[model samples]
Structures are given as structure tokens and as C-alpha cells.
Target: MNLGTYLTRSARYWPDETVLVCGERTWSYRQLDCRTNQLAAALIGRGLRPGDAVASLAWNRGELVETEFALYKAGLMRAPVNARLGRGEITHILRYAPVRVLVFDAAHREDALAAIAAAGTDCLPVPLDDVPGDDVPGDDAPSDEIPAAGPVGVPYADLLAEGTGDPVAVEVDEDEPCVLNFTSGSTGALKAAVQTFGNRLANMRKQLMSDESRPRPGTRYLACGPITHATGMGLLAGVFGGSTTHVLPAWSPEAFLETVEKERITATFLVPAMLTMVLAHPGAADRDLSSLTSLRIGGAPIAPQRLREAVALFGPIVAQGYGLGETTSVVAGLTGQDIARAVTEDPELLQSCGRAAYDTEIRVVDEAGRELGPREVGEVIVRGPDCVREYWQEPELSAETFKDGWVHTGDLAWMREDGYLFLVDRKKDMIISGGFNIYCTEVEAALYEHPAVREACVVGVPDERWGEAVKAVVVTHEGRAVTPGELIEFCAGRLDRYKKPRSVEFVPELPHNRNGKLDRKAVREPYWADAARRVN
Candidate 1:
């Protein structure tokens, strides 16, 4: 079945139910269904054929949601660019994906134009200022000139208005390409993970079956991060269950809390960094967040102690998930109940990302592909319907990462006797000091336990005697003071002396990548510049 059918099904089952809420605008199932149909017909009318690539560079908005459904209906491949990406990365994706139509939010007009010029492609540019049922953003008075069709791009409203407003009936096989999900190019060049229609369907099923963060009727799932990332993976699940998906146009700790209270948001997804910020926000304690039932955090490994703190502040409703872009949404998840158990009973389980999700098989394998036993740390590998088959066009990388029908997640972890998976650190990020392996995540988690530390990132620096020395970069909480010696002493209590950071550098804030994960590569780049080899 076409994934787009989920939206149509919701419209038929509950026509008046709200499926989307962006800012002041709300979209009912019926309205969203018809608009997407119109959009599909309109894109077809503009000479786009099935299998053509359509790229969208926009923030979280009603139009972006409509366009995704339209792509599924039209059988076009979706290439969603991160709005924060610079012209260079944007151009690379544009040319590599060979997008036939490029759509952008008015806010990104300049960047889109520049990328288009750089890529030198014949891609059509469409700037969306307003869509049907969308509120115009401006002062009490009217806004400035709205650009239409000439050098800039065509207005989305004009295209939608010209279409027949009927559903575009197209045959899309379940295995057909659906989304070209781009990986965060933190380690190297950007690559697109080719997610198929069947893979997405599997994602929907996994999300629905999950106990902790499942979406149900009237479930209000709020997304503070850009929906183009992991946060947007829940869109189809929302439609399937007759739930409403709320999007924050911008992100701020105070603003996010305000939305949860104002909208009575029942569930939401945030990266660990965002979770830290929200908990530290002055207004977080004062906000009325009792309505939130599921607080799902992912995109990075959060400190177990920090997760316990979040549960304390937000009730026992915090859930943690672990997955990569290659594995659609989440293949393993720590349920809210699991979190509650960790806080009250088994604090050790807090480090595990729960058991494998429904229908997903997880394995820890050594270098020779032999599965390891309990408490034995090795590379984590997973296989399931939700996992991607290959990277978009990179055959070599596809073979390397997707070996033997399994997606070899470079994360080093070990499974417990009871089947819980405990992540150590990224294989490449593991540091060896004096022949002792030290996981950076372990160190960071220790730093988070200190009350004065707001955020922490640990890396290995070049050293003579130790070969590679453990170094820590930290961001302390506001109005809190802590010295390097104090933080090192704190780590000494939780970890081995060799694993403790030999030196610590305090900064006002840590750098986060476009996807909100701490930019460890960026933080470590300067230190390695003068070294002959990054690793000792």
C-alpha cells in the first residue's frame, strides 16, 4: 500500500480530527488530505514524473508536511535538506540527488538561490509564503512584496490553486525509494540513506507497537527540533492513529515549555542536548508540564543520571531511544516504565537502551562477525524491516556498512543477561590511553552527575607518556562555578583513575551539530591540527 494512504485513511475515518498544528494554524484530516492531493496533482501538472527527486529546504511548517504526503502520493523521491546547512552542503546534496524541483520556505530564499546557482542544475524553485489554511506572519499591517515566478520562484499558492484539487492516483511499489535521508556529515562527507516505502511502513508499525512512546488517538506529539531529522519520523504514525502533530517554528527552552502547556502536549521528542537545556531553563520548573505523558529523547547517548533527573522533573514519563538514520526511527527503546524502574530500583539499567524493539534483532559481534556473549563489549549490529537496504548511490559504502543483511552500527555495546543493550561509545570515538580503552560517553556521563556541569564532551589528545591522554571540555551551569581539579576529582569517584580526564577545559557552551548532537569532531579538530596523527 502507498504510505500516503495512511493520511487518506485518517481523513475517511475521522475527517474533522486535527492532524497537524503549526503555530496558530491547524489542519484537519480532511483539509490536509485534500491539500496534499492537490499538491500532488499540481506537481504532476508542472511536468514532474514519477521517480523524480523533489527536495524541500524548509523549517517545520504545514506546507512541508503537505509536500511530503504529496511526494508519497506522486511517487517522487523526497530529499529534505536541513535548513541550517550552508550553501556548499546544500549544493552538494542538490547536485548529487539531482532534484528536479526544489522548494524552500521564504526565510531560506537567499540560501536556496545561491545553492541553485552553484549547483547549476535546471531544478525548478518554488517559494512558499502561504498555503491554504496557513496564517500570514507579520505585524498588524500587511507584509512587504510577495515574490512571484520571475528569477526567484513560483508561489506555492498559485500552483495549488491551478490544480484540479483531486487525488493523483499513482502506483507505488512498497520497495520503491521514498526518502533520501541524509546523514549528519560530522565524521566525513554527507551520504544519503535510501529509505524505501516498505521501510517506512515498518517504522510506522514499530512506533505503534512500542509500549512507552506509542501514538494513539488524540496524542499530541510536539517536535522542537527540525522535522527534517529524526523528529519528523513520527508524522505517519500520527496520521495512522488520528493524532495531532505539533511543530515548533523555532526552538528555545522557554518557548518549548510554553507550547507544551499551551497545547496540552501529551508527547514530544528532543535530543539529549535539548533535554539538558529544558531541564536547566529557569522557567521549566514554573511551567505547567503535567500534561506531558511521554518525553522521548534520542539522537545521542544521554547520561543515565541526567535521564533520572529529567524523570524527576517531568514525572516518570521519560523514554530514551537509540537508532541511526539508516534504521528509520528507533530499533531499541528504553520505556517510561523502564526509566521508572531505573530511578527507583535498578539504576544500572538506566545505561541500557532497553531491549530490541518489536521484531528487531540486535547482536553484538566481534571483528570476525562472531556474536558475543553477555557482558562482552563489541560492535552493535541490527537487522529488521525498518532498516535501510543501502546508501542512495554509494555502492562501496553500502557493502561495508550493510554487510550480510545487517546494518552494522559502529556503536560499541554489550547486551546484558536479560537482553538489554548497553552502548559504550562510537567505535571511532573510543580513546586508548596507556593501553586502556576509555569510552568518551562514560566520562561525559560522569561529568553530568556533577551539579555544576551543564554539558560535557570528552576526547583524546596527543600525549607522550600515556600515548593518548583523556581530555575533557565542559560547559558549566549558569551561576555555578567548578574548577578543572574539582571536575577531575568528581570523575575520580565514578571512574578508574586512568579513565579520568587528565586535563579539563571549561567553556560557556558546547557546540552542537545541525541535528543537535554534540559536535565532538568540531571540538576535537583544533587539538588534532598540529599533531602528526589524531590518535597517539
Candidate 2:
């Protein structure tokens, strides 16, 4: 069955229910279903064939959501480009995927055009604001910066209006490629995870079955981040469960709190960094946050102390999920109740990303591909219907990552006797100083225990004596101060002396990637620039 059928069923059952909300504007199930059909019809009429690549370059907006469903209905692959990515990166992705149609927002007009020109691809450009028909009310006119569209470019509205309103029931294979989710380029080049239609449906099932994070009828899911990424993964299940997905046009801590109160947001997802900012915001506690039922944190490793603080403020509703682009959505999750138990009986469990999600198999394996025992650190691998079977257009890389039907997550972790998975660090992020392996996350977690430390990222730096020395870059809490020696002493008391940061660099703020996770690679580059190699 097509994933688009979920929206059609929702429309039939609850046509007047608002399924999408952006600011004061809202789109009912009927409106969204009808618009998607029209848009899909328009794309098909414009020569879009099954398996054609349809790319979207935009932020959190109603049109982006509509575009996703329309593409699903049309049986085309959806490739969403991160709006913050550079033109060179965008060009590489476009040339690699070889997109046939590019749908972009007015804000990304210049970048999209420049990337297309640089790539020299003959892709048809469609302005999202002009997608034919009045799918959204008061959608401001296209910005003057948008180029005049001749035959090569078509107004989005014109195309939608020309299409039929009847539902598009394109026969699509369940295993056909549905979405091409690109990994963050923090490590190196971006690679797309080839997620099939069945994989997406599996994602929905996993979320719906998980009692803690499941979406309920009339539940409002507030998505503060870009919906095209991790936040968007919940959209299908939220709709399937008759939930409303509220999108933020832009993100601000104050705006997010206000939206939660106004919309009575029942559930929401945010990266650990965003949660840190929100907790530190002066008005955060003052807001009426009682409506929030599930506050999920992921996209980065969060300090246990920070998790405790979030639980204190948000009550026991705090949950943490862990997954990758290759794994569609979260394959491991810690529920709010699990958090409460950890806080009371087993505080160590708070450090875990929770057990394998329902129907998923999680394994911690050594270099020889042998499953490691409890407390033994090794590569974390997962297998299930939600896990992508391959990477798009990269057979060699695919074989290496997807071996024996398990997706090698490239993450280092250990599983407890009780099945909880505790992340140590990324394999590439591990530091070897003086022939001793030190996970940067362990050092960073200790730094966060200090009340003065707001955020910290630990990396390995060059050293003559130790080869590679442990270094810490940190942001102090407001109106607080902590010197390098003091922090080193602090970590020394809590951790092994070798694991302590030899030096600490204080910054007003730490760098984060597009997904709001700490950008450790960016921090390590400058220090290792003159070194012979990154490792000792």
C-alpha cells in the first residue's frame, strides 16, 4: 500500500481536523489530501515519471509537507537538501542524485539557482510559493529575487491548478526507493541513505507501537526543527494516529515555549543542544509547559546531568531516542518512566540510550564482527525493517556499512546485561593518547557535571609527550567562570587521570551542525592542521 493512503484515510475519517499548523494558518486533512492530489497530478502532467528524483530545498513550511505527500502519491523519490548547506555541497548532491525537478522556497532561491548552474544540470525549477492553487492562504507573493520562469521553470500554483483534484493511486512497489536522506557532512562527503517505501512504513509502525512515544488521537506534535530531517520522520505516524503536526517557520526558544502553550503541544522532538538552550532560557520555566507529554532529545549525546535537569523542569515526560539517517528513525528509545526509574534506582541507566526499540535487533560487535559481552565497547549495529538496506549509488560503501543485513552504525557503544545500550562515542571521534583509548564523550560528560559548564566538546590534540593529548573546548554558564586547571582537576577527580582534559579552551558558545548537534570535527580541524596526521 502507498504511504500516501494514510493521508487519504485520515481525510475520510477526519476531514475537518487540522493536520498541519504553521503560525496562524492551518491545513485540515481534507485540504492537505486534496492539495497533495492536485500537486501530484501537476508533477505527473509536467513529465515527472515514476522513480524520478524530486528535490526540495526549503525550511520548515506547509509546502514542504505537501510536497512530501505529493511525491509519495506520484511514486517519485524525495530528496530534501539542507537549507544551510553550501552551494558546493548542494551541487555535489544534485549532480550525484541527478534530480529531475527542484522545488525550493523563496529564501533558498539564490543558493538553489547557483548550485544548479554550477552542476550544469537541466532540472526544472519550481517555486514552492507559486505551486499552483490556493493550498495555503496568505502565502506571501514570491520574493523579487526569484528569477523569471520560462519553459524551464514553472510556477508551483500554475501547475497545481492545471492538475485534477482526484486522488493519485500510483502503483508503487513497497521496496521502491521513497526518500534519499543525506548524512551530515561533518565527517566528509555527504552520502544518501536509500530508504524504501516499506522502510518508511516500518518507521511509522515502530513509533506507533512504542507506548511512550506513540502518537494518540488529536495529539499535537510541535516540530521546532527542520521537518525534512529527523523531525519529519514522525509526521506519517502522527497523521496515522490522527495527530496534528505544528511546524515552526523559524526556531526561537521563546517562540517554541509560546507555541507549546498556545497549541497545547502534546509531544515534541529536539536535539540535546536545543534542549540545553531551552533549559537555560530565562522564560522557559515560566511558560506553562504542562501540555507537553513527550519531550524527546536526540541528534547528539546529552550529559546525564542535563537530562536530569530537563526531567526536573518538564516532569517525567522527558525521553531520549537514538537512531541514524540509515535507520529511518529511532531504533533505541528511553521512555519517561524509564528515566524516573533510573533517577530513583539506577542513575547509571540515565546515561543509556535505552534498549532496542520494538521489533529491532541491536548488537554491539567487536572488530571481528563478533558480538561483544556486556560493558564491552564495540561498534553498534542494528537490523529491522526500518533500517536502510543500502546507500544510494555507492555499492562499495553500501557493502561495508550494510553487512550481513545489519546496518553498521559507526557508533561505539556497550550493551548492559539488561539490554540497555550505552553510547561511548563515534569510532572516528575516539582519541588515542599515549596508547590509551579515550572516548571524548566521557570527558565532555564530566565537564557538564560542573554547574559552571553549559556545554563542552572534548577532542584529541597534538602533543609531543603523549602523542595525542585530550583537549576540551567549552562554553561556561552565564555569569560563571572556570579555568583550564580547575576543569582538569574536576575531571581528574571524577574520571581516570589520563581521561582528564589536559587543557581547556573557554568560548562563549560551542559550534553545532545543521541538526543542532555539537560539530566536533570542525573543532578538531584547526588543532590538527599542522600535525602529520589526526591520530597519534
lDDT of 2: 0.87
What is the Å distance of residue 460 in model 1 from its true position?
Answer: 0.3
Report lDDT per candidate.
0.86, 0.87
Q: What's the distance in Å from true for residue 352, model 1?
A: 1.2
In Å, residue 188's CA in model 1 sits off its true spot by 2.5
Best by lDDT: 2
Structure candidate 2, residue pairs in collision: 130-156, 130-157, 131-156, 131-157, 132-156, 132-157, 132-158
TM-score of each predicted structure versus truth: 0.95, 0.95
- Deviation in Å, model 2, residue 346 alpha carbon: 1.1
lDDT of 1 by residue, 1-536 (tens): 67888888889999998999898899999999999999888888888876788999887788889999998888888999987787788889988986988888766676777778889998888888844422224301123333434556677887777676576657788888889999854357889999998999999999988766778786999988888779899998888989899988878798799999999999999999899889888878888999999999898999987898898899989998999989987989898998998899998898888889999999999999999999999999999999998998899889989988899999999999999999999988999988999999989889989999888999999897877889999988888998999999999999988899999998878888888899888888788899876672
Model 2 lDDT tens row, 131-243: 22223243333343535455437767877797888999787898999999998533478999999999999999998998777886768999988899998889899888888
Model 1 earns a TM-score of 0.95
Error of 1 at 345 (Å): 1.0
